[model samples]
Target: MAAPALSPLARIAREQDPDRFLCALFAPAERREALFALIAYNAELARARAMASRPMAALIRLQWWRDTVAEAAARPPPRHEVAGPLAMAIRAGALDPADLAAMADAREAETEELPFPTREGFHAYLRGTAGRFAIAAGRLLGAPAEALPGLEARGVAYGAAGVLRAAPALARQGRCLLPADLLAAHGLSAEAAARDPGAPAWRALARDLLDGGGLAAPPAGRLPAAWIAAALPAVLARRDARRLRRSGLAAPPRPGRPLADRLAVTWAALRRRA
Candidate 1:
């Protein structure tokens, strides 16, 4: 069967996750739409949390996605933009409803005031959400269970970097994803750090998390060549994490920086670094 047509959610995914979108260009031509379906579905769930003013509001929105997935499982695809194409991917065996639900459930943590109490707690959250997303994408790209441990490592690294990079924006929304213990160790409060992104303690903490938290490691072992393209975004994540360590949580570079980032991603894909 042919891949589903690109939906509006595909545009949102391209805008929201340009790195992965760029990397997806390297996937087999026919499978690219399914990849976009996965990315778009993820973007839709993430937007649910970002747009919510309260945890309950976010939960309500997330539940809609959950129920839609369930209904899609039982009968027909939901008529919504993201859900329909997502259902196409599910039927094609490129998407898993279980992983979709897990990602949505894990994202509820975004609505909480202090989502992660410890570094390990944050890692667990990343594993369930972003890490799971990576493994699913890996499977779509034809990687097996043996490849998951490495993919999970890349996922956690990329997810943690993304959280750190969004610290300022998250702070504005009165949410903090940084582990409480890390902030405490640095004698920093989320409010104070948010107000002054260049604070010494914030820099120290950022540096430690990016450098010592295993965010720098590339994926290990032999992987499907297609998986290198799928995982190449983690290389950019490492680059951004390192930059955040030095410069603190400044605004991220605009995505799809075709000249620099695409070249970098291409190089990383060739090298099979992640």
Candidate 2:
């Protein structure tokens, strides 16, 4: 007999974020759908900002997801494909609505023209959204409470790297993610960075951001099997951060061949590395 088809949420996850989806494969089968659902929902939230043509459009779409989360809180078995599975994960993982809601709230920053006013502000934004997602993912993966700080750091690294990778695209949209103080310190304006991504000042700022992005050094020894799987994105993020610094925004890192990425994750899981 043939294998069953993936649900809508699973396909969203597998198609939109193959790296994290590949890592989730290490999770037990019965729990995999919940993981996919959580990731897919996050992708949806992210896409709201990525796909919107205007800030108002992004706000409208984000509001929709926020409302969906509210409705899901009031009632189980949400109506949409992504929401339904997300609701299940919420219940199964005992996730807090406030945390999920905060993720949506933080995404509002993405729609703004000048989002990160300061370095500390940028870090706080990342912690609220990406760091929060890591905590939620760890909970679903059955991570111990003691492991959360590590997971949160890993998430911050991935989130910062992801944002830095999107710098070119964001620049084209006439928006910048770099902190205002960093841009000022380098004597580079957002317009200048957007217009000439290859400029020396812009490259210097990118290198600085990548260096301070909170990408923790890999653990010296093996981690637990579950954590190793859950932290795979951080591994990929570190590679991306390095590439972003070396290559600049014009040549951000690619996801690489899917097979290679999956193999690397599998090796990491087997060896219990991040």
Q: Which candidate gets the maximum TM-score versus the true structure?
A: 1
Report every candidate's CA lDDT: 0.76, 0.75
List the candidates' TM-scores in order.
0.89, 0.87
Best-matching candidate per lDDT:
1
Model 2 lDDT tens row, 44-119: 8888877988889999998988877776646766677787777766665555567688889988888887858898
Error of 2 at 59 (Å): 2.7
lDDT (Cα, 0-100) at 91 in candidate 2: 65
Name the weakest run of 10 consecutive residues (lDDT summed) in model 2: 212-221
Q: What is the lDDT of residue 150 in candidate 1?
A: 78
Question: What are the per-residue Cα lDDT tens digits for candidate 1 across 1-274?
Answer: 9976655766767788887788887777777788888888788888887787777888999999888777765668878777788887887778778888998888887777665888888877888877888877888888777877778778777888888877887788677889998888888777765688776677788888767765554743334567665677677777777677777876646633537667877776666665
RMSD of each: 3.3, 2.6
Clashing pairs in 1: none
